[model samples]
Target: MPLKTVNVGLIQQACGADRNTNLAESINGIRELAEHGAELIVLPELHAHSYFCQLEDPTSFNLAEPIPGPTTDALGAIARELGVVIVASVFERRAAGLYHNTAVVLERDGHIAGTYRKMHIPDHPGYYEKYHFTPGDLGFTPIDTSVGRLGVLASWDQWFPEAARLMALAGADLLLYPTAIGWNPDDEEEERQRQWEAWIIAQRAHAIANGIPVVVCNRVGSEDDPSGQTPGISFWGTSFIVGPQGEWLGTASAEEPATLVAEVDLSRSEEVRQAWPYLRDRRIDAYAGLLKRYLDR
Candidate 1:
């Protein structure tokens, strides 16, 4: 039986140039968190290498690897050794020319639990993900693990309420986001602060609306752009966990690599839902127009 109260670990760390070094850093963090009583550990998105979506280059595809290849094998071993569940994000090489931003969930026994492919692909100045990854076809489905049912969404997918609601309706116990979002070098400090605040507020809203806890593990440190066309992005770490009522359980530093572990009482969701009842108040019958791309006036 699953425990009523679970401890989750967020590994917010800097990515190194070498894939092996980055993997080793994440592994060390996971081991430490497991030793400190974390039953479920999560790493930031694409933790195997630096954020390479700054520019559109076909050569970047070489970084993508098969899901069950080297990355999963290494993380699986750690999960098995530590007897803890691990959620890891990776750039997946699905086929000869196909790729995806996929999150793999590993059970305590080192077996593959399930995978969540990132549905939303962002295409901005610093994030040119559309050039690399194809939009995930897996849909918004939750993955079952020893800890609980994990509704794993990639970074860009966090911005959509529809995605979160779908996961919640599917009976996900917790919402998890393995993220790699950061500040654009040219943005003003004021704007950067607001952007970060919005990101946190949005996720908190999801927690309150769904009556489930939310976990976000983000990357930290600055990675330079190899092509020199633009200043590199400085990733704001700030990994956090929130309760069912949107109360913060714990948060990491915004500028440092840190491991944050927090105990969450999963049963509290029932109490919060009884008082707030956002899910029960939702008008599921009146959302037919949501299927359209736009309802122009």
Candidate 2:
């Protein structure tokens, strides 16, 4: 299964405090992307609601919605109408006492393709995600979609190359991340630039290493914590699409809300992999340190 190019649509936008407004804006953006020749559209993490990680409140759990509930139904409808595949981040209410930060894929035919829960749930500082989401039990896997096998992961999961490798092993052609990451508004300019650059570099490296295209869609704008206890995160928009060899195809601005599109050729993946041969090497037999939490023994 060679993917030479993949057309990617990244929706970067400033999130509002209102959930309905955010979802509506996302829908409109998806429509616009489709109109502009985007076969697949990806939205930022927790786009339907404010990045609730800003605070730890029991009431915040109320934002979780059932997977096949209203949200999916609406998304499925949109996928069908636009005839485009969609990757959307969601706060999933798995059961009465279980929840996960999940990425849902809607195939072009309007059916629920598959889903990947967020594997790395960060619970540090302003990003208090573990309070709201259970770590993904499904492991690293790609969803089968009409456009392609989507290697969809959540915000924190993007940092790990192991996650991307597992998806590539599962025959993913495109890596999709629905992310909401930002710096503490008080950070020095240098620190902010470093964080943003590191993010883009890490994902592009994944594409180069795995011989697959990477699409990262992030939320823009600033959010203030309702608790007033901490300065909220200032989300760096900069949504991007990078080629298999770490080449930049297109990128959104730092603060603008836009539906960014880039055409991809899905047939080049096999070519790149053949030339690089990174995956075919035999380090698998000796590298067992990855399984341990730490090499404390």
Candidate 3:
């Protein structure tokens, strides 16, 4: 089905030590964006609490809540009131010792449409996700929503192309990434620039290669290590909306809070695919190497 222009809101903000304040701030941001004609709004990953992964304490598990829990209940009403679809990322406490990073889609009327669990959990410094989240077994499935198909993924999932392609193959018009990526405060300026560039370039390549719009909602500001273990990552707030052809509709600056609105002409996906024909001319018959654990022989 061909889609018309869809307006998206990228809520970029820095998290605070208070979860209530952060959640309230994010909800307000979404409503404000909706007021400004944002039909679909996406917020940063785990926007509720501070970047809790800064520490590895079992007590931090308190930050994890159920999907229909407090955050959804609050945000759903906002979506229903504004009649806007919301792509919200949260830390899910499925059960004791069973937590997952989940992205829940609330349709325009606030109905719980569906969800995509974060497939790739990262264990790098300042981001100890693997310590808490069990890697998602839901695979790479796109959820259907009132606005359009929402291809949702959490922070670490943003780097993988296979995840994006699977979503595109499953009929995703735009890829949504609720990310919590950043540079370490201690890193040199040059190293920080290189890391940030790599993050943006990788996602752009995903959009260009998959021929789909990519929207990433990333956090900004410097989070102090609550656990005092590793320093927190200074989230570069370049949350962007890239076209199927990888054109930047709009992007946020690296050190500020802002609401970014981008217009997506969803019909261009078909046009670009038709021109490149990359998906059509694929030799899927002989690409079995991709499934192998390691092709090193």
Candidate 4:
């Protein structure tokens, strides 16, 4: 079980073309939040560089680096200096030709707690991640840390309840999503609104189902697509934290760089589960067909 209370900070920032500049900005944001008494800091996915998934080119592969590479080294030092736990997303260069979207947890002492590679890779209109990253083989398991047990998931992973449920079953105390999703410039007002609503509701539903708090940190601002075939995506940066009962704790703006800090009562999860025991009533025996692609005859 977690302590009496855990304070989580979400860093929502705009990604620039320069990776060095972006890393410095994220470091500054983490420091600012730590000064404000944030014990656990979460950063947006791929914070070191601009969203390169908008286009598929061989040059994008250069963005991937090793797990204990320079980025983690710098972040580990920051974590140690501030005595805070940090969850940072990165594009991992596992080998000469293989890469993955990975999240690393750094303990207060600057040692790496664990790592979770993104399982669900999206290949949508603007999210061409499949070309750059291979699906994670690290199964759905929580990373035990100094702060608490963290079930860290990537952007597209938030859309699937199975991923969240598996983490909960594995004893995850809280779910953290390092995300980078945005609105297409050509999307109509109504379409954009619905998409945003679904995005927020889906994660909150995960919190409600698993009886745990959820934290999401998303990138803000728009970056142009190099191909020039279409207008770039305007990242809707409404980073937020939701409670076990699907209640909103704190939320950032949809178009600005901001740091949101909120306190969550980890013990309340037990209370909520006792009152509404969804997990206890699950029919584990009747779910063998879930492995099939479809039930069509």
Candidate whose lDDT is highest: 4
Superposed on all Cα atoms, model 2 deviates from the true structure by an RMSD in Å of: 1.5
Q: Candidate 4: lDDT of 209?
A: 97
| Per-residue lDDT of candidate 1, residues 180-290 (tens digit) | 988987899999999999999999999998999999999999998888988899999999999998899999999999999999988888888899998888888998899
In Å, residue 165's CA in model 4 sits off its true spot by 0.2
lDDT of 2 at 185: 89
Cα deviation of 132 in candidate 1 (Å)?
A: 0.5
Best by TM-score: 4
Q: Rank the candidates by lDDT, best first.
A: 4, 1, 3, 2
Q: Say which prediction, candidate 2 or candidate 4, comes out ahead on lDDT.
A: 4
Please say which candidate is ahead in TM-score: 1 or 4.
4
Worst 10 residues of 2 by lDDT: 1-10
Predictions in order: lDDT = 0.94, 0.88, 0.88, 0.94
TM-score against truth, every candidate: 0.98, 0.96, 0.97, 0.98
- Model 3: weakest 10-residue lDDT segment is 226-235
Model 1: how far residue 9 lies from native, Å: 0.3
Question: 4-59, model 4: which lDDT tens digit per residue?
Answer: 68999999999998989999999999999999889999999999999999988999
Tens digit of per-residue lDDT, candidate 3, span 1-297: 656889999999898878889988998899789888999999999888788887688888888899789988989999999999998988898988899998999999998898888889888777788898999988888888777887887778888888988888888888999998888888899998899889989899888988989999999998888767667678899999999988999999889988999889898998999888878887899989999878997
Candidate ranking (TM-score, best to worst)? 4, 1, 3, 2
Better of 3 and 4 by lDDT: 4
List clash counts for every candidate, in order. Answer: 0, 12, 0, 0
lDDT of 3 at 63: 82
